[model samples]
Target: MTVDSSIMISFSTASKEYDNQTALRDITFMVEKGEMVFITGPSGSGKTTLLKLIYSAERPDSGHISVAGWDINNLKESTIPLLRRHIGVVFQDFRLLANRNIFDNVAMALRIRGAAEREIKTKVYESLKSVGLRHKSDSYPRNLSGGEQQRVVIARATVAEPNLLLADEPTGNLDADTAEGVMRIFKNINAKGTTIMIATHNKELYRNTGKKVIRLDSGNLVDVGKG
Candidate 1:
């Protein structure tokens, strides 16, 4: 497929290594603006590693990596946070603050970015509503179910309206029904024009969603398949 000039993510010959083990091998791909794509593979197939590269948590050992036009491979330490503002990331582990309530946790991103109090309140509420967790606004993370906590994490990741959403096993901990619901929320967000790259092992989930699929095996990108 021809990559559009309006691409939001681009990785050319990207690779990552840890000591003697290679996490990714000469991988190359592009996610265009407003596209929803799935990244699937078995465990240790470099799905998480690919997400990390886009999020700037890990740099490529060789080759180029760019997101939203910024050169991630050459991005400076101080500019990492700046780059992250344009990308939302959801992890298998919901990284919510144990001490904070749902509203506070989701609003934390806006607070760090110095959003006004009124804007933060409005945006946080809307974000929570999108994930069907507005009713749990005052509840603590520990008091919520696994799916609820994951929803909160999703709200936090998307509250700022990021250009790209990188989700790694987002539905890994949810039940079948709940996972379907979460995937719908993701689809809704993607439909609104944000680019989405979901790394999952659930082929059924991707198939049901009808998004473009990119399969990986042992760090190599295999093929782009239809859902």
Candidate 2:
């Protein structure tokens, strides 16, 4: 594929290794601005490792990764927060704080950036509303169902209005119906022109989405096409 000048993500021969195991091998691809893409593979196929490399959670052992024009392979520790502010990440596990209320949980993203109290409140509620969870603002994670908590996690991740969002097996824990609902929320977010990359092993999630798919096998890029 020909990479455009405005590509939001670009990987050139990127590779990552942990101990003796290679999580990724010479992976290369580019995602244009505002594009939605899926990284599909089976368990232990390095889907999670790819997401981690993009978000700077894990560095590549060789090659390059650039996100929103920032070179992740050479990313500095002090600048990680700045890089993350423009990128949102959703984990398979909800990763919500059990002690915090839904509102605070979502608001935390804005708060860490020194946003004003009023702005934080507005953004948090707006994000919650997007996930259909505004009414549960006062509830804790323990009080919500699995799907609801995942939605809250989504809300928190996106409340910062990131330029790119990376989700690793977002629907892995939800039932089919609930997973569909989560997918809809992602679609709505994508409609607003925010780029999204979802890592999922479930074929049902992208069966008819028509989004671009990057298929991985044994840490290698096997195919790139429509879903």
Top lDDT model:
2
Candidate 1 residue-wise lDDT at 196:
92
lDDT of 1 by residue, 1-227 (tens): 23356989888899999896999998887788999999999999999999999999899999888889888877999999999999888877878999999999999989988899999999999999999999999999999999898889899999999999989899998899999898889989998999999999988788766678888999888987867
CA lDDT of each candidate? 0.90, 0.92
At residue 181, candidate 2 shows an lDDT of 96
Residue pairs clashing in model 2 are none
Cα-lDDT of candidate 1: 0.90
Residue lDDT tens for model 2, 84-155: 999988988878988999999999889989999999999999999999999999999999998999999999
Model 1 pairs whose backbones collide: none
Q: Evaluate model 1: give its TM-score.
A: 0.96
